[model samples]
Target: MKTFTYRTATDTAGGLEPGAAFLAGGTNLVDLMKLGVATPDVLVDVTRLGLDEVTSLEGGGLRIGAGVRNSDLAAHPAVRRDFPVLSQGLLAGASGQLRNMATTGGNLLQRTRCRYFMDATKPCNKHAPGTGCPARQGDHRNLAILGGSEHCIATHPSDMAVALVALDAVVNTSQRSLPVSDLYRLPGDDPSRDTILDHGELITSVDLPALAMPSTYRKVRDRASYAFAVSSIAAAAKVADGRVTDVRLAFGAVAPKPWRALIAEEALRGKPATRESFLAAADAELAAAEPLKDNAFKIPLVRNLVASVLEGLTS
Candidate 1:
């Protein structure tokens, strides 16, 4: 551990130093620091910036501030009524005490819980790029199956992000606003970089569009509580007269970022809301997956999860 200076940031700009990291909730950052994965020389406390409000948008949408805690967001009346998927996703992660401290932006920015990434002794491309990824040949039963590169196959650990991606949420940062899909980048050649944010940039809020349809989030994990997802699906569908009118899907614990199932959505549009259609659409998307040796079960796991989520939505 390194000695560091601590300061409280009153505003969004002009407080960030060269090696400073914003601290809202230290749930993930503190863990990484203790593991020697992150060593910052400065800690900027942004918890009192007054960005914790969950306000209603003019057009029935919702705008959640970055500092809003996960527990509050999940239990908000508007969120529970309009975006049940997001609520379910938030509740599915961590524990009650941790969720009370975890913020919206912090949750979105949480790094992978990969054992290799956390182990400073191991060689992980995500922890130290160009070194090598031991999980590629080591214990990778809980790693990624889709959107992985030769350099890294670490799965993202955020359940809220998966739901937000499915809901087409936009991330508002101090630098610029972008879709949640564009917020995270796939590990192509640079596994060290987790997001597309520049240094000193800070997330301010997240905007979620109003969705008036059946939506759900489901996670399959090693245990029932306080466990990361082994395979998860966040889905929303609008079915009318036994045919799918519109649909959106995003997968978690299967890629570097939330795997938006655009191909599956395209295949399901205007198709009958039947088990066969769901299976075909799932197969269409899972066909591109390249599962590793130990994680091959994720191929069928994701396929069945996608189909089951859509089936439940339609029913």
Candidate 2:
């Protein structure tokens, strides 16, 4: 093991330096460092900066600090009542022990679950810059089907982020507040970068806007627990008199970012909450999907799952 130094940061400016990295729960960062994927010379601890409070905002929404644990956020009554999709997504990830240590901000920014990215020996653009992505031709069943580029096909693996985007949450940073919708970057040309966050900036809190809609998060994975999503949908809708008033949808494990299905939501707006409308919306969103040879199954799977979630929201 190489010798590395650890320091406790009093503030963001003083603690998180140019080359220094923040130590949240150390669940993902530590594992990557051990795999030789990430090697930081200095680990700046930021848990003691009083960033672990969960409070209700005056606007009838919730504000979760960056240091708040996943287990705590998942079990909170306010989150369960207003943002059930978030609670469901969090509970579906990690074990009891790991969730107890994983932070909310860290969970949103978790890297892809791509096998090539995890294995340093392989050619993964996410793991090693300029190294060509081998998964574009090799085992790509679990790879992205939408918004993928020739450079990389690794999917975004955060269930929490998918839920947050559908809920229309905003990410609070030291520089300025960034809407959670604008945080992710599409894989149009640069699949190497995942998010738009700048260096030396830390996520302080997440603000969920007030909504009078019903929402749910559905994830289909290989296992029942502790597994990354194969395809997931987060749907929030407001229905009145059997007509869809508003709709917000985001998909996971199908793209480089939380794939927000704007076309689907637009199709559902002002339409009756019927199976026909839901299927049409799903078809419209999946029309542009370009799947690889091995992952062609994901195209139909994602379309069907999106329709199912939309149908369930009708009630």
Candidate 3:
């Protein structure tokens, strides 16, 4: 690891200095530092910045503080009742010990779990741009199938962020507020930066809009738990008289960002809530998928998962 200055943040302004990185849970950041992937000169601890409360919004929604722990957020009565997808996604992520420590903001800021990116000795375009993406022809079974560029094929590793994107959550930062859907940037020619968040910008809170539709989260991994997703789905659907009134879907572990299946949502909006409809909708969205050699199975895997989840919701 690198020697760096550490200080508790007094305010957001103090946390925004050059070459500074926020330390909330340090569950992900500390590991990267140890691996020599991240070496910020200043580690700004913002755990005591009074950003740990979960407040009810004036408009019947909820605003989750960035410092709020994943365990707390998942256990909140309001979250479990209103947004079960978020709660389920949180529970499906990391182990219990890590969930107790991982914060909302830090969870959203997690780097790709690609071995090449995490292994400093390897030549990963995500870690060192213009080098090369070894995972392209290597062990890329868990890498992205959608939104991946020739430069990189890393997958975003957050289940919570996928659920948030499906639920239309808004991330409030020191710079500006934007939908979680727009926060991530696709790896085009440059893969060094994962998010569109400006350097030193502090994420204060995330706002969840009141969604009336029923939603759920599903993660497919190598094991039942404690494993990163191979592919995951966050789905919300509203059915009336056996017809799909509305729907929202977000895919994880298949893209550089939590991919909102707008095409699928559009396809299912006024269609029947049946397994066939679900499959057709999924196909519509995946028509644009450009799966790599080792991960071509992701196309069928994601399609079947989407169909099954929507089938359950409608049934």
Give TM-scores for every candidate, taking all chains together and pairing residue i with residue i.
0.98, 0.96, 0.98
TM-score of 1: 0.98
- Residue by residue across 1-315, what tens digits does model 1's lDDT show? 777889898897634768889988999999899889888999999898999999999888999999999999999999999999999999999999999999999999999999999998889898888899988889889988888899999999999999999999999989889999999999999999889998888899999998989899999999989999999999999999999999999999999999999999999999999999999999999888988899999988988998888888899
Query: Residue by residue across 197-275, what tens digits does model 3's lDDT show?
Result: 8888899999999989899999999999999999999999999999999999999999999999999999999899999
Model 1: per-residue Cα lDDT at residue 310 = 87
Best by lDDT: 3
Superposed on all Cα atoms, model 1 deviates from the true structure by an RMSD in Å of: 0.9
Error of 3 at 172 (Å): 0.4
Q: Model 2 over residues 1-315: C-alpha lDDT tens digits?
A: 345799887875532556577789989988888887777878888788788988998878999998899999999999999889999988878789999999988887788878888887888877787788889779889989988888888899888889988888899977778889898887656666678887767888999888678889999999888888899999898888999999999998999888899998898899999888888898899898989888888878887887788788777
lDDT value, residue 122 of candidate 3: 97
How much lDDT does candidate 1 score? 0.93
Q: Alpha carbon lDDT of residue 222, candidate 1?
A: 91
**Candidate 3 segments exceeding 4 Å error:** none
lDDT score for residue 185 of model 2: 85
